[model samples]
Target: MLATLDEQAQAFREDVLAGLSAPIPAVPARWLYDRRGSELFDDITRLPAYYPTRTETGLLNEVMPDIAARIPRGAAVVEFGAGSQTKTPILLRAIAPAAYVPVDISGDYLNDSAAELQASFPGLEVLPVVADFVRSFNLPEGIDSLPKLGFFPGSTIGNFVPRSGTDLLRHFRALLGTGALLLIGMDRVKPIERLLAAYDDPAGVTAEFNLNLLERINRELDGDIPLDAFRHEARWNDILSRIEMHLVASRDVEFSVAGRHFRFSAGSSIHTENSHKYGPRGARLMLLAGGWTPIAEWTDPNDDFAVILAEAQPNRFAP
Candidate 1:
């Protein structure tokens, strides 16, 4: 395995470099989860205004043992985008995985979580893989003997567009192997006002979280994107059942990168993130199409989000 920058990864970076000059303010959503972006997201979750993290964490806390019961014995527990692993120990404690694989790109952050989890769990082996989870992963060779159980909480599944979401889940299912399990957390559709409030919080952590994309570009690509020149915007699209986050340009500007100058219209906008809010029926249908059998699902009393367990479906998705 190339181990990093799979074919898709190579193409995506090329697309972004080309798209940067196409008269629009645009960046792919994957770039927003780098170390700094990850830190900001952790901070965002801690903000009182951010309810999804706390509420979903609470629901998972109550239901994890039952969730663990669904796992086949001696299963390896794997988590994608396993940042600080804030919610991991709960499941790990309950199921007590033979191995815990936390996949993340931030080495420092990933190692810290791995050390803490390994130290606390005593017998469980904590494997920290420091690579972008959006790219394909090579599960460490050590745990191949055990069955796999995939855990992805924090409602991070909502970050993808519908098609991309299903595709990634399919890839995830294949990686986990036959009869493998998938645990997914999703934000469900609700009153538009409530959805809007969650993203556009009073404390502005969400704003920082959204705008961190610019900072990532500035820091990594060596691009000069004046943070103050862009405005963070969030809106609820009732029709699509999604909350769209965007960065709007304050005025016309030109940027140069890799010896290329890209121009943006004065009022242009770059789409940052899309958090798909689904109804229960819709979520189940999506999972079914993606070849996962929705075994158990739970929702908070307020009806804001859902955490679901699904088993791998047949090979490919047609529906």
Candidate 2:
């Protein structure tokens, strides 16, 4: 269900407190999506160094004909983290679903995108839900009558840890029900130099994006973070097979949020995000663990990215 305003605020407060108290202080990446942060992310996607966006888009272009054939006409297309809805038009045009549900944590952006999409596709019913897709929420009216097909593009699943990713997939499985379809993008492991460069671009756009989180905290939570005291850093961990983003303190510093204060020693950092790259075997194993049966997969020519088409696994017992 959608969290109440107070509930959402309280959850944010608790998350901040917990993250600050951890040995490796960190904040949830979702908090980084205030209006400005969302805009910066949209910019990040267009950067020439960012391969996931264009590669995934290319995969969709090549495979949508087959992908659309599997999704029944008039099915409801529900997209998670529907930022800017850039890759959505491809699916919408190809599948021509009865309705479209776009879910995102950024309410304002979500609404704006929904409005633009509705204007572009007059006949398509566009419903934008402003709740975080990670939690349980009510589906839109009339969605229950149609076959639900989930579109989770942009490899956002990489943001979560493995367990959380599995939980999210299970949530989707339950929401979509048996026989529903899921089209998800997964980024593959690539060269460390390439991965690091993607997050730490020369333009400093990503640096601004990372630092903006502090600005957001300062604005919203009455925080007093010295933005200049910290710098954005992205590193690829060979052992973990993920790229990690951190806000490294340039010097000793202290900050407060909602009247509560926290401290950071020189060289200490707040881990912000992780993008885990998966190989084909790992991806399929993840799907099976989450109760999805892999149907087929598509990839770009270089195999740097993938779009997997999977169906909700059928109930094992007899109907």
Candidate 3:
């Protein structure tokens, strides 16, 4: 079941208060997707520098027939994040699932997307669950009996650190139950220039997207963060194999959120997000660690991204 609006507000307050107070101040990436943030992100996906969406979509279009053939008909497709109108339609047409369950924290966007999707496929069932996909949430009641095809696309998995990523994959495994299948997209480690451009686009939309988080904080949690006091930064963390997004304090600045005050020195930053790129071996290994076995994989011509099909197989003892 979804939390009440009040409950969600409280969670936001608590998370922001605690996160800002921590030694290394950082907010969870999931909080970056309020309605305005979501809209900004939709714009980000279309920018010329943003290759993941286009690359993944084209790859999915090319391989989805094979993907559909491997799965049984009438399976329920449970998308971890809100369904993308652009990408979800492609998969839906190819798989022709009996039902589609899109779970997301943004209820309004979810419903709008769901309604549009339902119109596109009137015969199929479109169920939108309003909850954070990072946490455990029950799928709609009737779909439990159907085979689940977990659709986690757009390299959203990259948002979490490796350990958290593994835990999240295991959470998906448990939620989908044994024998369920997962089709996930993962971005590859590419040239630093390309990666940097993808995250920190020249057009400044990405900056708006990052700063909007602070705007959201001010709007929802009664924060007084000076938006201009910080700037958006995307850096490649070579040691960690991820792109880190940070909001750096341009000068010493103090802000209050939920009646709690916080200060940051010039050059200090609050890490807002991470996008971990994975090599083939690393991706497969991470899946195995998360209780899923990679069954098949597809990639674009440039090899900038991958869409992998994995299954929650039965556990076996190993020497």
Candidate 4:
């Protein structure tokens, strides 16, 4: 069942409070997707600097025929995040899933996207579930008997650290059940310059997208944060092999969120998000650790991105 707005808000409030109190202040990237944040993100994808969306979309179009051949007809496709209007349609057209379950935390955006997608695919079942896909949630009834095909695109998996990402994949494996198939996108480890450009776009749309999280906290959680006091900064953490987004305080500043006060010194930052790129072996190893055996993979000529197809094989004892 979808969480009530109050419940969702409370969760957001709790996360913010706890995150701020942590030794290394940071917030989860998922909270960055409130309605306005989602819209900003949609804009970010269109920017010239952001290459993942365009690269992945073109690759999906090219590989759908091969993907379709392997996926059984009438299987239900449960997309982990909000279904992309551009990309989801391509998959729906190719595989013709009997049902498409889009699970996202942004309730309004999820419903709006689901409605538009349902319009496009009149015969398909569109079940929109508003819940954190990272945590447990019940899939809408009636797709239980259908063969399951999990669609996780856009390399959102990169947002989590490797350990969390593996756990998330395992969660998907358990939720989708044994014998289900997963089509996932993984961003490749690319040039540091390209990675920085993608996250720290010249156009500043990425800046706005990053700043919007603070705006969301203020609007939703009674936070009195001075938006101007903080600026968006993106850095490539070489040791971690990830791009980290941080909101740095321009000067010593103090803020109150939900009646709790917090202070930051000049240059202190709240680490907001991470995007971890992967090599071929690392991606496959992570999937295997999460209980999926990769069967096929496709990549662009430049090797900028990848789309991998894996299946949940039955558990067996192996040395």
**Which is the leading candidate under lDDT?**
4
Give candidates' CA RMSD values in order. 2.4, 1.9, 1.6, 1.6
How accurate locally, in lDDT, is each candidate?
A: 0.77, 0.87, 0.92, 0.93
- Listed per model in order, the count of residue pairs whose N, CA or C atoms clash below 3 Å is 2, 1, 0, 0
Q: After superposing candidate 2, which stretches have Cα over 4 Å from the reference?
A: 314-319
- Candidate 4 segments whose C-alpha is farther than 4 A from its true place: 315-319
- lDDT leaderboard ranking: 4, 3, 2, 1
Error of 2 at 128 (Å): 0.8
Model 1 C-alpha lDDT per residue in residues 67-167, reported as the tens digit of each score: 87788778898888763456888888788779989887666666776887888888988787876676677899988889898888887778887787777
Q: Least lDDT summed over 10 consecutive residues: which range in candidate 2?
A: 310-319
Candidate 2: tens digits of C-alpha lDDT, residues 178-277: 8999999999999989999999999999999999988977887788889999999998988888999999999999888888888999999999998999
Between candidates 1 and 2, which one is better according to TM-score? 2
TM-score of each: 0.91, 0.97, 0.97, 0.98
- lDDT accuracy of residue 100 in candidate 3: 97
Can you give the lDDT of residue 224 in candidate 4? Answer: 93
lDDT per residue (tens digit) for residues 99-119 in model 3: 999999888988898999999
Taking all chains together, the TM-score of candidate 1 against the true structure is 0.91
Worst 10 residues of 3 by lDDT: 310-319
Superposition TM-score, candidate 4 onto the true structure: 0.98
Of the two candidates 2 and 4, the one with more favorable lDDT, higher being better, is: 4
